[model samples]
Target: TQLLEQSPQFLSIQEGENLTVYCNSSSVFSSLQWYRQEPGEGPVLLVTVVTGGEVKKLKRLTFQFGDARKDSSLHITAAQPGDTGLYLCAGPTNTGNQFYFGTGTSLTVIP
Candidate 1:
């Protein structure tokens, strides 16, 4: 079974702070995606990494895929109140009919 687990189930930070969240799994994935979601809205894709050791940066956010393809990371710099939301990491399951979402990391950035 392929499963992804995220750490620090919740985080609260003041504006301008920085933080990192982790996603790990025992199974390898062909590709992994990071998404940020706001209340009552579907998750928006932040990035996708298909190669080991791949790194992609979007503004103040950075994402990395593990060399083994079994882990990933998300780093936020100079966080703002707008960054408050749920961050999720997901990958297509072996069956290909489902996407496995991580435990989820909820971040709150206070102004």
Candidate 2:
């Protein structure tokens, strides 16, 4: 079953602007992870927000998990061209044997 959904499948913004991408699901997760994939390399883990209502920042990128642990958001401030990539969120299945990933949001930042 499709467990995770991400919004705005695609996004393009000018440099220095801010943007937010969302990930939602009907099921609650024990922990949620965000990843960013560049052109060729594999998706790199950005952050893992475990607790509901928790927020974490990685430089200009900010990540937050919903209070119910069923949603999450990634916000970037003063977005730069280097931030262009495909953002994805993943959560382990109830069985804890595998992970379900979001559809993905491809972001392009114009310089």
Candidate 3:
């Protein structure tokens, strides 16, 4: 089974600061998705990338897929305290429709 991996497992930054998080995998997926999760709520999908080198922006956040389609990144410009949450990247596995999630990144944006 293939697995997704994330870097900088934990991040703490002050408000108005910028930060970047990464997700990587050796296996290529049909599509990759990014999610933001709060303490007690299910993850909310932020963006999905299906094409290699595709880039998407939402407000102050930018999402990018690697040219090889085996990696992804999220960058936040002037992060706010409300942005604190767990970031996850997920993609379907080789077998069936099962999806695998990355080793999550915990972000704490201090006000």
Best by the TM-score measure: 2
| Better-scoring candidate (TM-score), 2 or 3 | 2
Q: What TM-score should be assigned to candidate 1?
A: 0.94
Select the stronger candidate by lDDT from 1 and 3: 1
Best by lDDT: 2
How far is 16's C-alpha from truth in model 3 (Å)?
0.7
Per residue, candidate 2 scores C-alpha lDDT tens digits across 1-111 of 568999889999999999999999999999999999999889999999999999999999999999999999999999999999999999998788999999999999999
Residue lDDT tens for model 3, 1-111 = 438999889999999999999999998888889999999999999999889999999999999999999999999999999999999999977673888999999999999
Candidate 1 vs 2: which has more TM-score: 2
TM-score of 3: 0.94
State the lDDT of candidate 1 residue by residue for 27-110, as single tens digits.
999889999999999999999999999999999999999999999999999999999999999999778788999988999999
User: What lDDT does model 2 reach?
Assistant: 0.96
Per-model RMSD to reference? 1.5, 0.9, 1.5
lDDT of 1 at 26: 93
What are the lDDT figures for the candidates, one per model? 0.94, 0.96, 0.93
TM-score order of candidates, top first: 2, 3, 1
Pairs that collide in candidate 1 are none
In each prediction, how many residue pairs overlap at the backbone (N, C-alpha, C within less than 3 A)?
A: 0, 0, 0
